[model samples]
Target: MVAWSVCAKRIALGGSRNWILLLVVFVVYTTWRETFPDAHSLKTITFMAKMKPQGANRPSQSIGHPKIVQDGYQKAILLSYMRGGTTFVGSTFERNKDIFYVFEPEWSLIFQTMNEYQPLQNVDGTFQDPVWIHDADETVERLIQNYLYCNISGIDVTSLRQRFMLEARYTKPLYDCVRMKRNKMANCVKNFTNVCTSKKFRFLKTVRLRVHAIEKLLTNDPSLRIIHMIRDPRGIAVSRQGWQEFYQAKMTFTFGRVCAEMLRDIESVEKLPPEVAKRVLPVLYEEVAENPESMVEHLYKFVQMPYTGYVREYVKNVTHAAKDNTVGFSTQRANSAKTAYSWRAKISWKLSSEIDAICERVYKKVGYLRAKSEQVLRNYNISLRDPHISGSYVDKFRQFRIPP
Candidate 1:
């Protein structure tokens, strides 16, 4: 059976506690079998293995797509955190007329109905419930594979809520894909099958997935290329502070989680072997915004896409133009270049220092200079001693509550 169906079945059956325990053991064993006791991935090799006769829920080896023409279409992912320019980069991919792109399928509203499924906001490095953890892992793996293979149904963005979430963008292409592939039965099944076999460019943009999840994904599908997007932590902290959910938890806990994930993501890519390492391309938001023309061309080369005249035109006219990107649900916002480093002008020295204290190593590693100067620190201290200035700028994270 397809892996997602297996996960759905498990959730539907709602097995007893003991059954859940067994499932955890099975997931752990499978993860270990694929990753441990060896440097390479057995699971990925198995997927690439020659296929047997087709059966229900099994993918056929005879994917009818031609492999010789352009070395087969690519499967790419845009990996980043929320408010960290994911929408901006995903928009770049959307402008590619040939690509069928899905934005944050993992965070689709379809999964909101799953009772035991908790969102990324609640995941803090580990889960207290083992059953949910295992379930989450399997679901993520299935979603990643489904998108790579162009399983449209598995993309899970058909609902009205999902369309609204995407701000009605890309809906025409999404439905056109479904309409074009309808079979004699007037059903969507044939297109799903065709997409499975047909070679085409597919991209999945997500923010909720962690680095460990990405490692497991690579283990299962080595063909997938990752476009890891990073931003200045000061920018992230400043942007997140504007979000309503940022105040749901204390600043220390919320920002600490962000820093931890950022560190893990950077380290994960750094540790990959040469073969797998070549598949990852890290893009900085500031760099992309500052120099879209040069950066976009480099991205094309990195992803092995031709810098066609149309693509160049798109990058120059659409991607680089200043517009109100925050219109509807998008966050790219107006004046892209101006907004790239505007956090420096808005965020206070004390808050920037706190963000730097946690994100110093990652910021420098990613080519971002320190925003907090000694003079800024001195001014901040002088203000802190002044009751009037201190009251004007409330330091919510003054205590620096570190996560356990």
Candidate 2:
């Protein structure tokens, strides 16, 4: 039988007691606790900047639909947060600007789009005095180039890692800037409410990408379309593991680690306040590929893009790619109508029986499946509750608090 998707989280309140709740992610806890384990994230960040999109969200200019495309732009960054927001709805973009569908390269999108840029803010929540957020595109470009060389180039030396060591190194202006910012951290926090000072914050938050940063970008660039793509948990689990191998890194992608990262996205969606959720259009991998026309129609309206005949044709080819992606996987692809139960097939029957027994009821209640039997669900502590990955998804996750 196919199992359902349950986005498990890693960031618990204190990070231990309820470890069972996060067992799926905790598996990789020792190997990979935080998504990106670097200490650079220690830099303090303000919340306002976190409210916008990391990369520029202006509409595409090259998609042939001139009206929908924003004028005078080049590249744009996309936040494919977790499972659901990953759908390629943005792939059908018929704009002049090129749309690169980024699949969680961490904060690379923010750095790539207008690197070493600066931010400009105006009065009244509307941006006026504007500039690129990255301070120096060239410097960042170099960093990206060498980093990629060390990473994807498959070149010699592992010695190249030494070059990247200098990428984030402190140098006169950059070093002073980092230290200065560190010193005045509290003052910056106080200056956050002021719009003029607020724009400078783009740099602060970009250094650490957050959903709020995406939300802030949305506010500035109202025309950008946001599509949340979702895939089956099993497929994600398998795909991540595979990517880890392809890269051949010491700390490979663990099912638990990816699950922890995915939890953030799921929690973000379920926790969306009334307004933001409306702006976000959720499209499942299965739903979109299975019913392309209908899904595309809704996506166009959501992003305010025009559904031209050209757009429809492009969507067909993309869907074809999606269908082909499911092949060769050890587990069933997430797009099918069936539950992703095949994932359990890989585990020893003993473990599978326990997991299903423990998760079955809660799984079904969250729309993953219908209960095997009324009594079966109760036995698993599964009621009409939503088993989400985010702390936000749980009103009181410690207790079963489903919204009434």
Candidate 3:
């Protein structure tokens, strides 16, 4: 009877141990499935691998362990205004295979709020005024956080699609990582974060957000650098005015106001302390447009990227196209060098003078000529028609005029 009781007790204990093991496995699987779900399923990974660049034959960098990952990635933001040759500068980063480039992620949120009347809601679900939504100091902090994490949960899908398209060229590794099934869902999260965080260089390009919007990012993130691209106010004014008819309904301010914003943007940079100012590199559009190769080389050095033959060759092709001026939209084409001065021919002397007057502070600060040569003005037939600046409003030059 003693032997029989000992054997029965052993059997009961063994059965309970097996049940407990099975329960643990079940819980782990369920939690993982809930976390990642179907977006990164095995089937999707298989399809994406096949769709990856033709003849490419390498597995993605492992998401193996967080401790194993290196921590010296450089982050950069292209702070710019409309028609400031931002695209040309941004294209350089895009061509480099090493950089994980995010083009205007802020556009989907910032511009949408300004252009549309619909209230924007924060993560907390409270509806916010369109203009005031992103003005809060916390808004840009949240933007930088989301951008670094490679997460797009807060952005509107439609705005992202319309403004910036993520091609297969950059997203191959992201797709490839979903193939790892050992740790399943944990791998999915870690792999995505690892892939993004492991990159040596990460760039975010934005023409919409002001320097003040991202001031905190400079103070907090030691790796973060700001490339503030400024064009002559005359050029920016001309570009915005060119789009006047198309954006008839959206005009909320006069031409002087447009120039005021340029000064305000420069002031935002000036307000930064010397330590913060050291991180900001101001690029003049004229310098870049005139000599893209040299400017790009200098910029590459500033960002700590080695200037390679690949980048040089790309610059040659781009500048050559700009010199040739083959396309209608110079900004879109290879000939941005020529486009930089194209504004000089388009705007009248009076309008240019108005922009220079309103943007005098910025011009002096950036070392730009306040006005074009009188000879050049004569050649371009500088006459002011006093056309409506936007939506039946005339230029505010008269209102803000200073005594000569």
Each prediction's TM-score against the native? 0.62, 0.39, 0.62
Best by lDDT: 3
Per-residue lDDT, model 1, residue 100, is 61
Clashing pairs in 3: 322-334, 322-335
Give the better candidate number (2 or 3) by lDDT: 3
Clash count for candidate 2 is 44
TM-score of 3: 0.62
Q: Compared with the true structure, what per-residue lDDT tens digits does model 2 show for residues 1-404? A: 01112332323454665555556544654333232222122222223335454455543222111223233322223334333323344445422012212222223323224322222221122322122443223223322322212222211111111222122211122223223435442332223223222221011101123344344333333344345444444434434434444322422233344334445555665565555455554434555555766766765555443467776766665544444354322222334333222333333333323334443433332234333543543343443223353432222221221112
Indicate the worst ten consecutive residues by lDDT in candidate 3.
392-401
Q: Which wins on lDDT, candidate 1 or candidate 2? A: 1
lDDT of 3 by residue, 341-390 (tens): 66777777766676667666655555555555656544534422222333
Q: List residue ranges in candidate 3 displaced over 4 A.
A: 1-70, 112-137, 151-162, 166-195, 241-244, 247-254, 322-336, 372-374, 378-404
Model 1 over residues 229-268: C-alpha lDDT tens digits? Answer: 7877777776776655435357556777887888888778
Off by over 4 Å in 2: 1-88, 94-210, 219-225, 242-253, 269-273, 318-366, 369-404
